[model samples]
Target: MEENIYNNTYSLLKLIREKKPLVHHITNYVTINDCANIVLAIGASPIMADAVEEVEEIVSLASALVINMGTLSKEHVEAMLVAGKKANELGIPVILDPVGVGATAFRKKGAEKIIKEVKLAVIRGNMSEIKSISGISVKSKGIDASERDIIQNDNLEYGKDISEELALKLNCVIAITGVVDIISGEGKTVFIDKGHKMLSTVTGTGCMCTSLIGAYCAVSRSYFEAAIAGILTMDLAGEKAYKNLKTIDEGSGSFKMKLMDSIFNFNHLLKNIILR
Candidate 1:
């Protein structure tokens, strides 16, 4: 089953690169452009539509749906709920990014509502957010994690446990992303020990990750396959971009473009390196 999952992911990556699945995103303000650009770089089309008036229609036509609660509003949440229900009814894969789930009561409540209302194919978030939703005892400092003290070597064991717990509860794939990424679902767990610290310096990158997951799931049927593929692909791209940046000047701007370029370059190589 694991081999089959990896094979499926590689095939899905190629399919998305060739077919350019249309992704409908009702995402936050931060990294919205990054999400769209990353989608295009990976050979996927992106459409950002949050209007309640057309969210249903837009979702109806999309190949995949991505909901990011990074910058939440009452109106956008309503639109997301509406679009999410339609996607669920139509069997379109939905990827939820509960960005700052533990940041505030509003964020936590909103994330809970969405998870309960939709059968999300995947939920990707940091340790704090994951712990919050899973009923663990991590105090959320703000929209981001303030307590990285507990993270030792990405704490792979804890990550796997948390991922399994959440996946079992939601009956969906759960990915806890940090220095390392842990993805679990369907009684399977995988750890991706890739990615660079440089990625952490950039804002909206995590949201971009959720968008990538959406793109992968748009083309792959297995939730686990898509989640694993998406994380590895992003990590590989980030490492290559970081290496290239060393050759030139280093800054978010140059690094960002190289990230996209590396993704374009690694499209085929990644498929071959995929564990199967």
Candidate 2:
């Protein structure tokens, strides 16, 4: 609702393209490629290396680190710890995407362990995923947010309260991407309701969003603003991508490509879009 929440956001996008910082990722393999390209699309370089044997070395050269538990394993979590710890030691912000964290004990345990061990700059997930991490899960649908758990206009205020509480408790930004993305941290809550519903139909959109956040983290002055910038980019990109499909009736495949194109040309498309 504030002007800085929108008007000042364009500067962050431009800064990312100008700085071109390297982002390190220990993300899931399912959307690893998508995450890398999306970071590149937003004008930051991506260096994805999850091997525990060399994560410390790799993270030393990165400006930001993204840890996604979308596809987790013992070895992957081990590497995440290595890379995450190194990122913290170097003062490199780390962003976590707790994908499917509510679906299984394994993923949940892995996410909790990472949270405890590494000080994250941002934790990006949907309602169910974020609620689960905060010790409250309103049923999850695999990796998706439960319909019953989504934050609608009627529950928007309540959603902001809980998300802010979680951000305070965790000492990091809480980013929940959904019908209306809510970002809360440092006693601030910024909501960006710019995305299309068709975004949920595509796979790895959340992962890509986290990666975009990581890229912004690399260059932005505030993590809260960086989260807003990253999520706003994806949400606005989704709107543009879906608008392109309305005339032809294409599906997710076409939508995916167009989404990337929108991000690739984000500087032009993102101008003057008002925020809620």
Candidate 3:
């Protein structure tokens, strides 16, 4: 099964090279440029169109659509709903990032609306955010989660159970990212024990991850395969970036640059990346 997962992940990476799927991103402004650049870097074409009037048209031409609720507005949320519903009708995959799902009433309600309206292929978010939406009572500091003081908090037993239950309930792939990333669906759950701590230091990394999942799904029909690959790619890139940053200074600026460089150079090693 492990071998099959690795094979499946590599196949999706190869599809990125062959199909070069077009990804339509209705993401936030904070990481708009990074999201677009990362899409191109991963060998996928990206279109960032969020206006309600043109969203459907843009989605019509895209193989997959990504909607992020990081910097939400009524207009953009409407556009996301329109585009997401249209994508569902067209059989185009849609990935949703419930960025701050538990942070505010507005965010939770907005996320619920999208979930009810769109047939999401996959939904990705942090532990606290995912827990909140999945009916857990974990608290979040704004958009970020508080550290787990207990060592048991990092256990996959809890995560796997939550992921499996939520995936079944939502009828969609659920990706929970943290020290370890888990994707659960269809009575099976997969975990990718990769990624660096520095990844949490930068903002919007999770949002960018949602877009990358969209890019992967654009070329592959299996949402599970696309999601696992997306998480693996993130881990690989972050590990590589940490290696490059080992000699650099410790400012947020330098860390951000190295992270971007890692994603930009990720394609060069995708074929040989190790996925566990």
Quick one: ranking by lDDT, best first? 2, 1, 3
- Residue 161 accuracy (lDDT) in model 1: 84
- Candidate that would win on lDDT: 2
lDDT of 2 by residue, 1-276 (tens): 556666667888888888899999998888999999999999999998988999999999999999999888999999999899989999999999999899999999999999999999999999889899999856779998888878777778877888999999999999988888899998999877779988888889999999999998998778999999899889889999998886566999999999999999988886745522
- Can you write out model 1's per-residue Cα lDDT over 1-276, one digit (the tens) per residue? 545645766688789988889999999988899999988888889999999999999999998999999999999899999999999999999999888788788988888898889889999888888888897666777767657613346477877787898899889999878777888998989877788888877887788888889999898878788888788778878888888886545788777788878766665657566632
Worst 10 residues of 1 by lDDT: 145-154
Each model's TM-score?
0.93, 0.96, 0.92
- Decide which is better by TM-score, 2 or 3: 2
Off by over 4 Å in 1: 1-8, 149-154, 271-276
Q: Which structure is stronger by TM-score: 1 or 2?
A: 2
Better by lDDT, candidate 3 or 2: 2
